[model samples]
Target: MRIGELARRCNVSTRALRYYEEQQLLTPGRHPNGYRDYPESAVETVRRIRTLLDAGFNADTIRIVLPCLNGDDVDMCPQVAAAIRDTLHGIDEQLRDLETKRGRITALLAGRQL
Candidate 1:
């Protein structure tokens, strides 16, 4: 298969596939003509990548855990668990910061003291 076929099967754009390759997430071989030659298993690899990205896992974390993924199941070793916990903690911190900003804005709108 080629890049186009892999992108179609994965329902993602060729640019996205290229970006994935650039991110070192997907590795496809090349033909003598300089065209990318993707393996048949690339389809499943793309699927897993998309699933992890949609779940808010960063490319760095996904790279670490990609090999641990088998279909929808994850090995969830200590590293994976720690990665997940770190992501969750980051999200929580962002939410708390947003809440504080919202409270400050609301107080300003209500003309109340902080």
Candidate 2:
């Protein structure tokens, strides 16, 4: 299928698909007319990319983790495990900061001055 069809099927914009290509997250073949030709599996790949992005993973992290998500034996790589662990740690720190902000807001709403 072409890029438009893939975008329609994936419910994402063509710009997003192009961005994915630029990020090296998606690889579509090129037609003689200079159009992108995507395989059927591109739909599922896009879905997965959306899911990861929704979960706060950046394109680079997603690139690193895609092979693992695709059921490869990446667990054997200690560096991959470390990178994932670091990402999780960062997420936990962000959650803690958000919780602190929420508590301050709650206190302010409760007639307490910050």
Candidate 3:
């Protein structure tokens, strides 16, 4: 299908699709007119990509896990395992940082009079 159809099916903007392409997350073919022609699988692929994005996984991590995404149970290869472990570690650090920041913000708010 065309870019517009793929975008509509995924409920994502054309620009997002372009960004996905740039991120190497989605690959579309080009028509003779130079317009993008995405395969039907692109719809599901975009959805999977979006799901990973929503989960706070970066594009790079998504790319790493792409192969395992199709399966219900992730039996990761060493490479995929490392990628996921690294992502989890990163998220842990981020959560700790956010918790600290939240505490500081809350203290500041509490010490101030409206």
The best candidate by TM-score is 3
Pairs of colliding residues, candidate 1: none
Candidate 1, residues 30-101, lDDT tens digits: the string is: 999999999999999999899889988899998888989877688999998899898889889999999999
Q: All candidates' TM-scores?
A: 0.86, 0.88, 0.88
Worst 10 residues of 3 by lDDT: 67-76
State how far residue 50 of model 3 sits from its true place (Å): 0.2
Q: What is the C-alpha lDDT of each candidate?
A: 0.91, 0.86, 0.88
Rank list by lDDT: 1, 3, 2
lDDT of 2 by residue, 1-114 (tens): 998899899999999999999999999999999988999988888998898788777888888876677533344377667767878898999999999999999999999987
Query: Per-residue lDDT of 9-113 in model 3, one digit per residue for the tens?
Result: 889999999999999999999989999989889988998889888987899998889868755566588988999888889999999999988888888889953
Best by lDDT: 1
User: Higher-TM-score candidate among 2 and 3?
Assistant: 3
Candidate 1 displacement at residue 111 in angstroms:
3.6
Better of 1 and 2 by lDDT: 1
What C-alpha root-mean-square deviation, in Å, does candidate 2 show against the real structure? 2.0
